[model samples]
Target: MPKALKIAPPDDVLTMLEAGVAGDRVAFDGGSVQLIDAVERGHKVALHAIERNAPVRKFGFPIGRATRSIAAGEHVHVHNLQTALAGQHSYAFDTGANVVTPLPSTATFMGYRRADGRVGTRNEIWVLPTVGCVARTAERIARQAEARVAHLVDGVHAFAHPHGCSQLGHDLDGTRAILASLACHPNAAGAVIVGLGCEENQVAALLERIPQARRGSIRFLVAQASADEMAEGVALVEELARAAMAVRSPAGLDALVLGVKCGGSDGLSGLTANPLVGRMADHVTGAGGSAILTEIPEIFGAEHLLMARAASRATFDAIVTLVNGFKQHFIDHGEPVSENPSPGNIAGGITTLEEKSLGAVQKGGTSAVVDVIDYGVQVRARGLTVLEAPGNDAVSSTALAAAGATVILFTTGRGTPLGFPVPTVKIASNHDLAVRKPGWIDFDAGMVLDAGMDAADAALLQRIIAIASGEETAAERNGEREIAIWKRGVTL
Candidate 1:
């Protein structure tokens, strides 16, 4: 073992060695000379054996239970330890809560305060179009408008998505709902709606879904009025930017709608960053705010766990219905949902959808699922919720931004350059990667994977608090705000 790496037994739980924990069988740094069974040298000591059916505890939670008897010094691994049961009945939030202790109230983040009692992390001007036909014109206008008024909002940008002009049924409704949510997002201090005058998504319908406060700060333009001219688009966008720059103020954590996501993961991701970010999610949600977890495909093989954590039976069922419905949609398209994993995921040691999912779900933390919404629906509940979106990090992050995520927590084992509309914090899987890619990785949670860091969970939670409260993350300093919207079925 390296001199800097050490391991200490957790004080909260006891580890049983051999047929029983006969003595103070401590797993510490640099001193061990007992062998009763077969074991590998490099593998983690988590494989040490004990009595049959013994429970494996971490973070004071029963992560798994041993399925077979084992001798001392033997590896306690997946082959012998069965995973903990995942179901609604397994966790009892009210009566048998895990953490009944109240958390400190001193925690807070400085954010942009909105008029209707919401908070924003960044001030931005949005140039949105009701139809794809106007997307080019909107982009041109945004570029000019941003240059004209660069000092006002954080940035002026256009979401050039390949949707809003085709299809039928729920797909159209999904697009309309998402676009409306974009217009009302807290990060958007002001907005300009550009339309082709005739498209599947009309400006009137989009405006109706925007909140009252947002409606007061928006401007409208039709390409027909500009004779479909590019110069007209730039002029209208400039006017909207000037108007948006006039309003700027401090916001609070309550105004934040956190977008949670994970990409290019490995086994250590669950053990490290995901759960750490989850702690942050819990804090944000507990502070009378909202957090959004998306990537429908990533949640595959783990929807049942989230359903069980739902605040109500209705919410649970709603999420369950979405999982099944999306699966059916994929089936209709002659593709398996399991095929969604990226090449990087496989190279980094992830296997099967179920195996990957076991860790992916940890990012939601222990918060109750307050709402289950379709793609593009603005988050309304004041706690953890599920957002409908594809597994692609860019697309899901974009939807979260559209639905109002002021910050995104993105985890990766295989480093990604992807950023988001709001600020993003990147957590690395291992210490080696964190040190090697200091420019991209903000925090190192791989200490949990190291030998000595016993309170991995607690330490990570503290780090998350620091990041959420204005601490610069690697992604933010690198200026990463990658956005992509999943338009699975049709443009409309």
Candidate 2:
């Protein structure tokens, strides 16, 4: 039976939420309680009045101190909980070491081992476009390739993105670097670099930049070239797919690059889902495997927590540099970082961006920050590394795979149907969503909150081992391949 039908939330909370502006009454404290002030989405309101200097609570934590006396049941949003006035305190790393014990025996996920010693959870050939102009052609080629060689790999997807041309300096360089990373992604057995002849980003330029070992496995095709003077890129992709499918074999556990991510979060996210994924990351890294945790915007308030676990000053500095860069990027555009938390997050009870970010960073667990790389930079080194990416779910997940993550563990609270071209296992942060979106979500880590549940960390670790060892993720089984790429500038 579907458990979602059974777990009903209090009608009062639901009513209050729907009522938005106009107040609603809820039975509480043996009487009906009335809301004094109505809150707009992405805004805030107080449940009760407080004296001057009193603290404002968000997500059950102190977001900021009241600047002055505030009336009860009044608005306690940006007016009271000031972002600048909020306390930005540091935390001690390894705080959960006492509770989370490492796995006893070494565990492994079945993966595709590459010639250069990288492990991939999915086996596919990505058709890379050197410029955005060729994305449509590349996508067509990928579709044709998948159709022609259905039995070759689990799936094939075109890395269709909005960047790779226009602008100058790091903007252009960033696109190229990211494209290089996608070509070298672990899930891809090989890649076909497609170009439209004349573009800022040329296929030959990429060949010169890519490492010799990576170039060995990649095939390139230009739309301008044809034996009959006709652009038959689809036929080219089919030929490449045949060659890629022929190079298939079992890659071991150590060869995997696990991408860790979370979205649609709530208070329970940090308490359950994030920690569970963290433990799994530790296990994968402990076995000499790689795991990626990105979304730089999401790591805003929690960078210090990660800094403390950094292996060295360089690694820590790298994390800091990325955070500062993102901060500056927003500031330069006159956008506040507080503008980040989505409307869904606000609806789910998250008040401030800091409060939301604190919970979001828990997905990385307690492993030492082994390395910090810029956007699209390949993670050659092992262990836990942070990639520079936006807070957007699909964009970050794509960045993670581009950085060489083989299998991905993505956690969500509000239930997102987002899946990657690679084998992305979606774990719901709460049971309510897990049961509701069974087709989109795989594991329910929400059981951690159930009464009498013993050591959720252990159960979660076991589930990770199972999923890595050939268990199909719900998203994979349902054929969900959601893709989105974050663009730097406005597209007119």
Candidate 3:
């Protein structure tokens, strides 16, 4: 195997595939370099001398600037590199640069077709709590209901979150929106919305946000109005399950909506997992399918690249507002816009926010920004849609589910076992992590390093189809389903 990899021709740094001590020579595509300082695996090594304050290129873009003069083969990391990101800047819409050729849409997967014309990868029944006070009640109801109806449908699940009460204005609306969205998710054959009756987010009010056609498949229960909440909830779920027992049928690729995300990212993220997911994104959107990319904060430095692909001037303006609004959120809270790349990221070899952002955006592929939606809005476009969400794993994943992602393509370097409302296919950036956490990873993107992206892409697409057709992901098998609401306002 090559000792290091250079992602782009203009990159002045090479990412080490293995640890190297001083004086060790690392070979790459065009040339070789002897290490001037000891560098760990996945860390960056300068390929040539860099002057102080000069930008260091990676992924063919400036990741950051050199903090001081650096010698050839010197280790490049936080010690010598710093982010150059600041508050947002103006942007201009580029005309006709984002057009994508729609591929032949012959691919099909077996999925459940809903009454509303949406296709579902699963036929499970969901129990949702309107207030935090009734979360456990919902869980208890789902457990009992699943035991009885496991043979009738996929499975029963209750998504519990500590919100729906004590929230004001948009914060309260956010809770309602997410819950309403989940209740209407195509994956759920039917859903039961349990409310505490007196909470700010009442069951009746929440139902108003859901479409009139979708409300027929959903049941609601007010805990205070019930004689026995658990029994009432279970009965409701059983009724939904009976109605949800539908057989899967062939569905076209256009029915597939993917959520592309990355977490616990490492240096190899950009090279392997992310870019691999990017190919899948392109493939999906090329076939007229939809894909959603979130983690607004993670795209700070790379916002321009996405903006350049805006479908129209209106889309470009939305992209600008999305980027700047997130930055302002940080500033208003006295936090820097570049306050990211967590300690885990640093240890995994990522240096600055720019480097991380540049790598993170690859999951979106090169698709045109068809639309930019706010938090809690279900996706309406037929291509890559940028959703407003934070970079936190659960929150963004939940938002993705709420935005109508049937399956989430999650790429990671460091591993996480979390699954959201939908099946999350975890792709590992490096081989070591895939081997180390077999239970957490569904695909090894590290194969791209050796077998190349085409091979990896084919394999991953097959795995995704299988998963969509009812093959359980690692997260699903491990029973790691959960949700987290983005609590952006103060408590009452």
Candidate 4:
């Protein structure tokens, strides 16, 4: 039997956890009401009669205006509702604030300490290409060198992406930033940078951006400079491998950089996976580590909640710009800003961006917004920071990897089989998804509802430590790794 979940006191709709036939009595705090319609799991049912064109509330806020008069115990979804968001709007700092308690540093995770005082969860050797032209050559070098260097580093893998050449300004800069960030990422004990001569992103300029101490670990090659690029690239990787084979020092939890994200969301996301992950985020940030939250556009309706917890007025202002800028970007592209809660989301009982946003942000837990960063920028602060990115999973996840997230905590309701260059821990929002897709899911956050929250949080924190100590994620085993770069500017 599915019990109806009415999240807030003022909500006029109830999300059914399982289907109920007509006349079934559904109970809430006030009293029990007879069901007048069949409400599927994850779908909503009207708690009270709402007049035509009146607001339909969920998460204790208006999700949309009802298109037709809805009877109490009737289904409420796309057919009877429409979005209410439009254009840019004025925002105040805060009326009510989010609470974040400072947790004592008592927990720790064992990790590898780099020579530059950084920490890495993995010690793989990464091969990065300056342009798409040499992506194949970079991969060839990795494939051939993996066996030769298996006895040295953790593994040798190449990250290949499209669109490196014929790009101007930010487009080209975005490519360089992403590749360079990954090249210097903690997971990479050393890197083999492959460049096709004449590509806009040159080796010397890229090397200049890497940390001064770690620059020595990079091995460079220009495909056009050698007749046998494959052999030359392979030789360079071999040399890089031997250098990376050096022993790594033991490190603690403070060195961990986690990227938190949610995708394919449903009603259960907020109540289950996202909030659970947010608890983990708070744990990591409170323990003196770092956690980054991206998918900027997804934060739309719920921006005010985060703003209330902003560390300073400057950070709040940046959040405003980041939000309004994305709205304007949508306008310039001739797309509606309220175009969200995809078909799948609606089918799964998410009605509006507000509801979605509210649920989405639970992944941040109660952390204060300490910093904001541009796409491709690495995290420096030791708390929660926001990054500029669209809601596209691949692009944002790749950006998270570039931003120095040694491990990515990805929560999903519908679930995705995709993986980034780093270890991606897929957390399922519901037990059914976890049961059905055991191969794809690494954690079952749906259990948060049944098990005690404290026990769940402690278990998840331990799970994260196990992953940090070099346990292989399902994505790594299934070979779903890929990278997506943001292309915002015009191409020449």
Best by lDDT: 3
Model 4's number of clashes is 0
Estimate, for each residue in 391-468, the C-alpha lDDT of model 3 and write its tens digit.
999999999999999999999999999999899999999999999999999999999989988899889988999999
Clashing pairs in 4: none
**TM-score of model 1 vs. true structure:** 0.76
Off by over 4 Å in 3: 6-8, 98-102
Where's the lowest-lDDT run of ten residues in candidate 3?
A: 96-105
lDDT of each: 0.65, 0.66, 0.92, 0.84
Ranking by TM-score: 3, 4, 2, 1
TM-score result, candidate 4: 0.95
Per residue, candidate 4 scores C-alpha lDDT tens digits across 328-403 of 9999999988888887887777888877887888888787888999988998798889988888899999999999
Instruction: Please estimate how well model 1 matches the true structure, expressed as its whole-model Cα lDDT.
Output: 0.65
TM-score of each model, paired residue for residue:
0.76, 0.80, 0.98, 0.95
Models, CA RMSD each: 6.4, 6.1, 1.0, 1.9
Model 4 residue 459 CA deviation (Å) reads: 2.0
lDDT (Cα, 0-100) at 479 in candidate 4:
84
For 42-149, candidate 1 gives per-residue lDDT tens digits of: 222342445677765443344456688755454444566555443222323232132222242345556666777666666678788777787877888888777877
* Candidate numbers, best lDDT first, in rank order: 3, 4, 2, 1
